[model samples]
Target chain A: MTHLVVVGASLAGLRAVEAVRRDGFDGEVTLVGAEEHLPYDRPPLSKEYLAAEECPDPRYREEETFAGDLDVALLLGTPASALDTAGRTIAVGDRTLSWDGLVIATGAHARTLPGTEHLEGVHTVRTLDDAVALRAALRGGARRLTVVGAGFIGSEVGAVGRKLGLEVTILEALETPLARAVGERMGRALTHLHRRHGTEVRTGVAVEEVLSSDGRVTGVRLGDGTEVDTDVLVVGIGASPATDWLDGSGLTIDDGVVADETLAAADGVYVAGDVARWPNALFSDVAGGTMRLEHWTSAADQGGRAARHAVDPAAAKPYETVPYFWSDWYDGRVQFVGIAPEGADEQIEVVAGDDAQGGPFTAIYRAGDRIVGALAVDMPAEVMKYRRLIGGRKTWADALELAEQRRVQRAQKQAAKERGEGA
Target chain B: MRINVDWDRCTGMGMCESLAPDVFEVDDDGSLILHTEEISADQEGEVREAVAACPTEALSLDGPIDA
Candidate 1:
């Protein structure tokens, strides 16, 4: 029997094993995870998991599904220490497991503030344990919350802190927060969303040092010799791909485990999730280069696609997608689709709604003549439509036409609602 | 199969609509619109794929319903 060993029992790892069985691979499968808990959703960790009075169980499925239905051996809480790709063996703690097919879905680790690893009030939300601890700190009489980075995670955490009635402050080194993901214009608008709430946002400032007293975090020292006092400090700087175990495994590694369009990192080995850096065929012509998406949707999609290619190489096709991700802050949702263009010929415009107001709006990103990406503020259905256009490599004109159609639709809906009220 | 969405958990991520557009749609107001709750046998594979793709774990497939 073909025994497939899937490393990382998170979202990608769980989907990888499921895909293997779904594709009629009756092979013996062993799933190894660093955490003891079965596969659970991670997005909620920074949002709902942190805000809720009682923590919610976010497991994708129960324990019985993996053990009984999937018929796979579970090795939880034991992280893979090393990989011998030539011999097809993986070292997990003290045990060495051999496999015919391998799926590396190890994912990424949250980048914490240097020298604050042992600090009492410092936290990063990458795992369930991390979220639980952060939630406790937030609820445990934390009067002031300071987030080092103004990224999605930091923004969400800061938003939650405000909801919990804590004084919140966000520090970002970039001139404009979320500029890389949503362009300068939209990023500035999003930064306003934080200020609209009671949260204080300071841009173009770096945390020079983390200050602590009695082994607990007290505040942060800014680059310009200024200090911000805080009871809880969240380092949402970002993450580094967990590729330390594959140091000499011969798989090409840059920012992440480099893979081809097929997601094959090596012979009989596939990579998926946040760790897999592969060229998405959808933007092959856009010159966006190889991409690594940290979105939950991409993780699950790439996991299943990589597993199927591993099982049957002959039936493999190049994996392609219009990458998508959504972040919830306060009462609004921020969604982005496809890769945003950089440098010259890049155009970003508010296609629908008013960008001036801190309300619902849709912005489309363009490169040359084609629509490359879109950022939506509380505009969900409209954004997905643009995603389809991006996937089809539609022109800028096409995007404009679609935007007009949506505007008309919205107007008609509003008019009908008004007519009903008048009657 | 009967498609069920936990309205409480569904944040209109549109993963289901992306996988099986015919069965599901996210409206202008950002809420999921189930075109048909009772899906046919032929639609089972893609419907299952849609159910699996939901990030929020909101979508569920129930019954090969009794004829």
Candidate 2:
């Protein structure tokens, strides 16, 4: 019987196991996770999970989904400390387990900021326990809070902290929060969303030092000679792939695990999620090079694709799909699709919405005639519409009319709602 | 194949329409507008992908003609 060993029993690892079974692979499957608890969703840890003191369950699927429903064994708590890729064996403490096929779905870890190594009240939200700890600190009546990095995690954390009645301040090193993902114009719109949520936004500011009192984080000193005081500090700096175990294992490791478009890491070894930085076809379909997406949806989709390729490498299709993600700040939602054109963004961006009142508009990115990327605030449908346009490689100049029509329709609907006429 | 969408469960995320544009369409405010009730064979795969890809798990697939 073929034995499949999967490391990092996360969204990617769990879904990879399910994919293997769904593909009719009657093999002995084992999942190794570092965390002691069952597989839980991570996206909510910064949103709904932090919205209230008592929250809904964060587990992706019920235990029944893994118990009798799937033919797999769960090995939680112990991580794969070492791997002999050539020998097809992974060392988990004293146990030496070999596999017919291996998967490296270890995901990524939160990057820690300097000078906060042993400071109390400094936290990151990468795991369920981290969320619990942060929530506990906030619920314990921590008045003032400061968040580093205005990325999705930082933005969401700031929003949730305000919901918990904490005075929150978000600091971003870049001029705009999400410049890399949504470009500067759209990022400014998103920044307004955070500011509208009662969270103070500071940009182009670097936290040079973590001010502590008796080994507890008191605040952060900015590079621009500004000092922000806080009782609790949440670090959303970002994350790097959990590739420490694969050191000297002979697999190519760049920023993350470098893989081909097919998501194959090595011969029988495949990778998924934040760890696997494969050249994506969604972005490269129009342009030429590779891209990596760390969103939850991308991980789930790519995990399944990676497993199928691992099972039947010859019959597998290259993973090709539009990358998408959503971030809910206060009452407004920001949905983005595809990759934004790097460097010269102004020449390619054709925006169609106003950034007023938390920005309920859509901005489309184009490369030549075809659409490349899109960012919509409170315009989920437009994100979807543009995603199809980008996927279909449809010309954006042609769809601008439809975009205009939708804008008028939305304005009418909003007017009706304001006049107490529409639902 | 027959396509079904649970609006109560749909958060108007637009995963379906964006993924399988031929079958489903969403409005500017993320309201659903069914374009095609019966999915073509070629689009079945894409529709199923959309259904699976829905974050809320609000989409389901049913098919193979009752006859």
Candidate 3:
């Protein structure tokens, strides 16, 4: 039997293992995870898991799934220390394990504030322990919270803080929150929801330093020399792919483990999820190079594709996906499809419904005449519609027309819902 | 090639329309409207890609590619 070894007990790792079996590979599979607990969902750590009234286990699969449902071995809590490609083996602490095929799904880790590493009440959420600890801190009455980034993770954390009734303030270094992902115009629209939910949205600024007293973080100083007092600090700066273990393994590593269009890293080794950085022909056209997306859907899709490639290299196909992600803040929801305008050539802002507060709108990014990206606020169905357009290689004119149609339809639906409630 | 949609499975994500607007369109009310069921030689590649991109597994191709 061809034994396949997968590193990182993550969504990608789990999905890949499941995919190979589903495709009838019948190969021996072993999953090596760094975390002590079983694989669990990560997105909910910032939303549902963080905001839950009662804390619950976030395991992606139950005990039975590993024991009986799947034909796989689980090595939890220990990380692969090194990879020896020539010998086809990986070092997990003291023991050396051999494999016929290897998968590098060692995803990224949450970045930390420069000076707050050792300080109390400072956290970077990437694992179950981090989420559980953060939830405990909130439940333990830590107030006047401050978040250092306004990107997806930071914004979601800020919203969760507000839900817990913490005085939350989010600081973004860019001109707008999610400016790099959605563009300035639409990113500005997202700020409206934060204000309505009692979270301070401060843009065009950055967290300069974490204020500490007696080894506990008390506040943060912004780039403008303004100080904001806080009892808890959440650093949502960004992430770097965990490719350090492959140091002497000779795999090309730039921002991530460089992979080919087929998600192949080497002759017999493959990579997937946030760690696999490869050129996406569709989105990379205007952006100019490869990109690594760190969304849940990307992990799931690429995991299956990578596993398929691993099982039968001869039948491998280039991995191409229309990236999608959804976020929630209070009563509002934001969904993004394809790359944002920043990744494309030109940005075309479109509004369909009279939302009165910039809550409902669609902005499409165009590279020449082709629709390259889109951002939809409180409009998921439209995001899906735009995804089809982007995949279809439709023109900007078509996107604008479709946005107008969605806007009018959404407005009518909202009015009808209101009328129904009144009656 | 011919295209068949499992209407029950289609979430109306409309990624198909995004792939080949000439072939597919998902309206605002979350309904799918296929422009045509027949896939031309030129559109076979994109049409196949759209089927793969469908998140809900609602799309499938019935015949061999003319290309």
Candidate 4:
């Protein structure tokens, strides 16, 4: 391959370009991004960036240094319009670029409510621009913040709003926040974490209509006719994979651009990041093989893997990973690794600290005899151990053993600390 | 080669520890403990992986160590 084209100068796209150089591909590399800014970290947008008095610099590398070091041609502020698989060409803005190999990392766009698109004071935290605007609104003397969605983004925004001393309220359509993903019991336990910090979490409610005045949002009307008064509204309803440009491109499009076990959408065309949906053999038994992750870690891993495979197809290996993601809310940290297999009989057990007291805890999700997932809140080290176990497809009994070991070690450490303090 | 960590960007996520257990560790209170700053030839691959895997982009590799 003489020339390589990476679509979506995102986290995945940047990594793909880096991997190409690392794999000794001394060819022309072009990275196209919709935004003008260089590749920056997105996780901080909702956390520190929003909470801080000044926005923190989140760029992975400087634009000039990155381009000079990688010898890449960056097409920033230019979004790819379409793809031509047969001709191996992509439409970026007014120009058409041909490639010997392509990595599609278009990623996803934040989903907004239907009627609220034109309303002011409504924000979504998917991109840096979105976060910046939202942070400005928060710091611009906005009194009340109403978040429409109890998912990670919504919860984090609510937490940050509360930290800024705003009256924050989180609305969830489901009876329990994250009930489907983390089970009802654990979901309530997590939602309670924000409540401890003075964020009102209203469950089993949907936004019936967004009330506005003078082209600006004032509040939202609930499904039950109750209205909330607010100065700003945030719609964290989630996101859809940015695959609209790939229409009729001949690649199978399901929830995302469906790829094979090798992450190849077609010959010489590989897909990565949130836009690529492929069969992860790691969770084949649990999720029926098909999986797509929107996490930062997976994007980095799959970006490099897809690039390496595109450069050298013969040495390519199937991309199997123990999916991992972490979220920061209030004074606690939430992390989850591995797939919580969807089924009626799936079990959730708290093997670590007590969950009822609203403190630190680790819960393992089981599918029959095998441990499929683990969720850790404020237990970082123990979570990594469970991630290893989940990747190995270990059993419930094995997880229990590990939990017991952790308990014994914790007790020993506590006793030693007490002895030292006594002396 | 030497590994340089941007302490301001590091949140003690322990991703480096997970990728290269021998090179890094996260204490109980979520403080990062770097065992070694210099990277050996044998451990370069995993250390590079750890740097790339870091979500915050806080870890970076400098040029080769001086003689």
| Clash statistics: count for each candidate | 0, 0, 8, 0
Per-residue CA lDDT of candidate 1, range A1-423, in tens? 388889999999999999878667888899999899999999999998899978888888789999888988899998899889899999999999998888899999999877999999999989999998999999999999999899999999999999999999999999988888777778888988899998999999989999989998999999999999999999998999999999889999999999999999998889999999999988878766899989998899889888888777777789998888999999789988888777522488788877766558888888878898988888888787887788888999999999999889989989999999999
- Docking quality category of candidate 4 according to DockQ thresholds: acceptable
Clashing residue pairs in candidate 2 are none
Q: Which portions of model 4 show Cα errors greater than 4 Å?
A: A343-346, B1-3, B35-42, B62-67
Report how closely model 2 matches the true complex, as a DockQ value: 0.52
Query: Taking the tens digit of each residue's C-alpha lDDT, what string does model 4 give over A303-368?
Result: 988887877777778888888888899878988888766542248888888777555998998886
Clash list (residue pairs), candidate 1? none
Which candidate would rank higher by TM-score, 2 or 4?
4
> Which candidate's lDDT is highest?
1
User: What are the iRMS values of all candidates?
Assistant: 3.7, 3.5, 5.1, 3.4
Q: Relative to the true structure, how large is the alpha-carbon lDDT of every model?
A: 0.88, 0.81, 0.80, 0.87
**Cand. 1 Cα-lDDT:** 0.88
What DockQ does predicted model 3 obtain? Answer: 0.19
Could you say which candidate leads in DockQ? Answer: 2
> Residue A257 deviation, candidate 3, in Å?
0.5
What's the C-alpha lDDT at position A253 in model 1? 94
Full-model lDDT, candidate 4: 0.87
